[model samples]
Target: MRMPQGKPGRRAAVPPWLRARHPDPVQDDPRICPDQTRGQLGLFPTPPRQFARTHAARISDRTVPGFEAVREELRKMADERQIRARTIWLWRLEGIARLALAARDPDREQVAPQALKDLLYSGPILGQALHRAGLLAPTASHRLVPPRGTGPTRQGGQRDLDLRGQCAHCLAWANDRRVLCAACTSWGYHIRKHGGGEAECNRCRRTLMVSDGMCRMCRIIVAETEVDTARIAMDYGDQLWFARPHAAGLAVGPRTSGTAAARGRFAHKRRLARARAADELQPSEHVLNPAQLELFPAPTRDWSRLNTATPPALTTAAADLVADFFAYMRGRGWNINFFRGSIRTLRILTGHLGADAPIRECDIRALVSTGIHVQGARLINYLRLRGLLEAQPPRDLSVARARRSASTISSPAFAAAVHTFIDVLLGQGSTPSRPRSSKTIENYVATVLDTIETWIAQGLGDPREVTKKHIEDALKPLHGDQARRLHTALRSLFRALKRERLVFRDPARSISLPSNRPVPAGLPSDRVAGLLDRIDDPRERLMVAFVAIYALLPGQLVQLQRTDFDRSKGRLRLRRAGRMDHIVYLDEFTLRLAAAWELHRHHRWPDSSNPHLFVNRNTAVDETGPPISTAAVTLLFQRVGLPAGRLRIDRIVDEAHHSADPLRLIELFGLSTASATGYVLSAHPDRKPGPIAP
Candidate 1:
């Protein structure tokens, strides 16, 4: 559990500070700083004490025994008119003394002194005035005069008296559950349980008295909504409960228009104020307790404990720096693109800005360039929306850089890592949106880790070799599967390693993979024809039949466009269609069916300007070319009675069957690596590792 750091309170200034610093000299241990946490509180006072003697002429009513007689008289008066309960109590207390004194001795007993009682009931000054007139012996005559000092309450040598808050209902806890108690839950007349003398309800008002745990008229009043539920509370009253005023946005009244409403609100405030004053109380800030935590069912996957790696480079400071950069750009009127995907990339690039950085440009390409063709397109779309890409994107650039394309996190490794975490947190597994023939995300993880381990082994021994060439030399010995995996991991590292600026240059620069096939074989030819012929759905039949005839790669088979076959032109124009070179033309039968199906799907002429011919009906976007999803089409063919087969009996996409094509089967499916557009023959496959040429 993380322990929260407490915020420091505000420092008091001037009057408050000075008063807090100094204390009354009269008291013992009168050091100003009372709290240990605050250490020594500095108090300043220039003037020295000028003590003056105080005196009062009148003494307390307790000196005389006429209290009983006074109470009777007041009760008689109360019978006829009005007197407060407190007043009645005072009279009774005085009367008891007076009556008892009379019983002691008639001759020596002085008459019950009204003057002395006056001093006790009223303050010292009133009693003193009467005493000076020679009516009473008031030994304790002087009230502490002129109040010792002058300043704020805390500053002045007077107590910060308990605030007399208005009477309001406050919540209290009972047992383990919430409940209302005597305050709001129960009502009763409260007669003083420990009675000095009996108290009658304020003379002439409904009589109510509190004794023990009971009250008379209190019960009736409690049911009454109008009962004084209002309560007075000190600013920091221990048991006080307060709620914010009902008015919201009222504080933000129009500059001039709502004067009336503001006045009304202020008037209500004034009423509450007046009520407080009547009770000798004031308004104060309300403090509340933190709520207890409630329990929830445990998560499906336990993340509570694991030696989870703390993200090394993705520091909060770096994240903040990136945010500030965006904000700064926004402030400067820069046209900025907003995207969550770029969050990781920007975080990696500048998060550790000026710190030991790991990011460089080449990692950019591996991050952004690889993956489904549409991945880059999606990012481009996002950047364009944010105003990052000002101009339209150009046609496909044959060659891609590993360093320049990373916009998400540096590379596939981060993507894999993030995906791994996401899956673990969700209690599932991660897979790439566009998975390769045999590459699992776990494989990427293993490969990346391997690549990192190799680097660490080679370079950790000597830090100087951590340069780009050193990485290149380390990679030079690698080839085939290891080389690809090594390069892939290196790619991911370089992509995210931008901020570290570890590499002298893009390490994977000038390195390219070879065109190869894991061709399917060992199936009789009849099974292939039978699979295609058994398909009844015209679309599935044509798709499968065409794949069989052309022996195209999965990408080419999926990338087939409506424009590939032109009914008017009577030919299929295949662009770098696959690992094959040469323009492919479909047979009349296949071309006609593809064209007819497209024509049949059109409920009405499609909106002008869409170029895709084999468009997915489900995807509503106006695609550049009408398209069909390869996976969906493959599945559809299987649903339509196609059987398991290899080269001849090949299942198009399912793992159960491996589909393959010969390396030089180009003419059968016209495809050019550079531009599949209206192809011509090439002696070899395009340098860009796409379709191989016949």
Candidate 2:
């Protein structure tokens, strides 16, 4: 044997004379070259070439009996650890097999079953490998044992079992017995000679004592302590117990049963019912804190006092007209605020016209007598629209007609040109196609008319003589949105006119609007809290919170149905514009507030059949009011001096400041990448402001 020169375990380099001449000793033929096996195998007769080939073929074909089983066990373990690659699993298997082979004799050609078993159960590296491979049991309580004589020998005539057999009592491996295992002899099945008892606990099947049909541990749980019983009785009141005020005793006995026990049970149930009723009546702390409570005091006026019934002083005809108007507004989806305003207006209108005056006899003059000119005009228009009053020509009709007939180069002529352009857009002219809808055409024409009127007022009336300077002058005074609209409309009109050869030039083409300016910084945190504190209505407070914290749009907030809120998961599922559902996790405060609001809403509108989470309070016309409109939600925020758009911008900016990642904004707030990037840039103090294209 050769030894290494320096290292303790390193092998020495073999001398050239002693080195094997052939790379593979198995393939070396001693008959062909007598020097190949000069020392050892040369003394024996050389095996035939055919025998060598057959032996090698047999060796290649051999396989372990339970190789597939071992592989499957390893696959399960790999899957448990989220290792999906097949090559990695194969490598692990190869390592485990090599370790198993090297565990005992290194020179052995085959691994012994006894040696493999010992390696598996030795609780070492090999044991862990076997456990991971699912060949060895995970816990001793569920260990398997080999059949009777097939197991390994142990001390005291005992035997160690394989992983296939288990003890009957504890489901663990038994040394020799077929039923009870050696380790489970004491606590599990008791031998007949060792005082085996017949009585056993129904729960754990352990031996029972004289008290009840349970073991000590189970008895301790089923039988309440005196302290526990007394606590329950004292805290909740004397309705839960059946025992007659016994001296603070704590003992296990037969369950009490009698008329008194039955009565006690009934009283306990009644008390629970009363407590639930009281809970419903009390304001929920979860919904509002002390500060919020101080901000929004409870309503003292009786809801029944509202004049939902017919006004006693009004005539039948007048009352009928008022009812019809209310119904009309309700069908149009007008909010509670509108309903209230209309009600107040109606009171003033009815008061102006005496109770005896017929509704048909009333006119705009009657509304004007109330000393509110705007309200009078609105009332007259509404009554006329609803056919409750005689229709009359609008006050501006003569002016509009005169402008259309005028031919001179004046403001009226410009107005007439605008009307003609509007007609062209509405597909009432020589144009071949009407690409814009009536609503869009009206909006475009209105914008163009505004610019034309501005120019005519500046003493420039000839449409042919309109220049880019005039267009720029018209656009300069306007804000970004107004300028953009006017520019687009004028461009469209000029393009149409040029195609028709009506204009020699299209001056609007050179007109451009500046990019939208970033929103102003939001109110300070203390100011925002102060604003929230001023909102007394719970529903309004929740609506503002959604905008102020989550940056939910008005449309999104109004469209929220009861099903969107998941109380158990503390998540709100919002369906965005593209019908994609976005889930937002609620914080502790929001969760509690939501829970309280849900309870309050349920109680306030118990009979309401609307599925919307937020509903209108106009119960007179709509018994079960509809979902709150986006306009109403906007007004709610406006009432507290917070613009919804600015609130959303502030929230996005704050989020950007914290994360400084535009992608996070896009993911959380559903903003476009460009929009998110703009907000992020605006948040940075070092970044210069640049114009983004409108």
Candidate 3:
């Protein structure tokens, strides 16, 4: 192919093949110069040369002699480079021009020539440029001299002081020289300022300025809140002494406050004045007005003080017996009230027997001869129980029967049958395949034994002689459910007897009872509110809320532990027998109440090892301090004149009516399908039944 030759001043020819690929190559290609060819491809292009010349001319026009020298040097370097000479020269020129423009005075039109030259060749500036372009060796120290005409360097120590002036702890900004910001300073200041130097109100523990030792708010609260000061003083005279009115006003004082200390000093003075009156007191003067004595009992003389001085005229054996009686009462968990009553009884016995009498001479018969025989009988019983007296007290048949009521059976065969049946139900006897709850077995056995005993008391002595007529007579007075329960127990008993070949016929086999009953509608809302309000204790209120709002059964509530409540999720999970576990979502109010009750429970029973959600405060009777029994809960509701069971039924009925979904009710309350269906029907009796889908 033929090549096209260049025009007069144009440098070279382009090969025809190159021209053919791009016809009129200069006009077609933006990057290719008309005078440039592949032979000069590595050399500087004309466009970059023209750009450098224009920039150098502008720098020269500014009369920056240092910049002009830099531009000339850049040109020399460009000529030395074989490749990208013009581009390299342009970049170095641009870098020197930028430094000159930056170093120029803001008020002046031109930069200092010497300063511009110094900055252009400075190690820091050149090293920075190389570092920015990623051409400097990373391992090599890139530290360079500071450029001339730069402002003063920041003081390291001043910067550290500024940083420290800001909160050293929280690192928040501070206006003044402080280690901590205003907020942090205030927090610590308040803590130390109010720690404990000032006197605090006894009721609320708020700081008090008045030496009376109560803040204004607590004083107002005490004024508004009614308290029987007279009754409190009468009952606890030593602990609750009233102060005289001061010039300011009448202020109710707590025994734990400063007023109490003042009152104690005044009381000491009064006691000194009363010493003469006490010395003049005759035997007859000791007799108190019966009416006044009922409100504030006459103080008993401290016999221990007299005994310590004169060893009490009573024999050593008698003193030992008295001491042992008190020890036994204490070991049995008797309260101080019992000790007080026992002390009074002992005083009467000692006065009657004459304090000098021997313990062996003080027989129960002789004590009974004094006409106050009940005290004598109690003392004799205690002596016998403690093995101090050998002769056992006569056993009253009525008391014996009452004590043995739970175990008593009319016939030995019936008793044996009942035991065997319980063992079978508990998976311990001959027919032990069908295991049952021990509690359920106990209930069934009690009912069966009671029914059998009643029949025997009515003249049917033998199980074989008892007929269906006797069973009907015994169950006649009971309600429908009660009758059904009795019948079921009797039927199971007779079946077990027949299995054991002890009886041939089942008296309760023919007795049929209704299988379903309408669910009871709960107490009215106003009544429920009143009952809940009547329960002031947080623990009791929370328990009632569980039954009334969550529809928890007594057994479920009693079994609930702290682990059952999911605080994060605000849900209570319960495991029930014969149904899927239930999860109840708690509302904010209920959750708050639960939390408050939990805190109160911990405070009241701090030493308790019980994990129950609700626990009784009394740990003497129950060593483990378990949850309050269902009977105790029932009694609580009874005291408030509300039925706990009815409240639970009300909650269930309310939920059933509101949702009308049997499956939802079953899931929510752990109710059986049949029970849920019954509750739904009872809630909305007028609703038509839907067709069953098969």
Give each prediction's root-mean-square deviation over alpha carbons: 27.4, 36.8, 37.4
Candidate structures ordered by lDDT, highest first: 2, 3, 1
- Candidate 3, 578: how far from true, in Å? 5.1
In order, the Cα lDDT scores of the candidates are: 0.38, 0.55, 0.55
TM-score list, all predictions = 0.28, 0.36, 0.41
- lDDT (tens digit, per residue) of candidate 3 on 522-592: 56778776666676888788878888778887778778878899988999989766656789998887898
Show model 1 residue runs off by greater than 4 Å. Answer: 1-450, 453-522, 533-536, 577-581, 604-609, 620-666, 671-694
Please provide, for model 1 over 402-481, each residue's C-alpha lDDT reduced to its tens digit, 9 standing for 90 to 100.
Answer: 11122133345433443443233223433223222222334544445544455555534322244566566766787777
List where candidate 3 sits over 4 angstroms from the true fold: 1-407, 433-446, 454-461, 476-479, 619-625, 690-694
| lDDT over C-alpha atoms for residue 343 of model 2 | 61
- Residue range with the least summed lDDT across 10 consecutive positions in model 3: 41-50
Question: Per-residue lDDT tens digits of candidate 2, residues 556-652?
Answer: 8877888998889988988865457888777887776677777777666555556777776542123333556667987887788878988888898
Better of 1 and 2 by TM-score: 2
**Reference-based TM-score, model 1:** 0.28
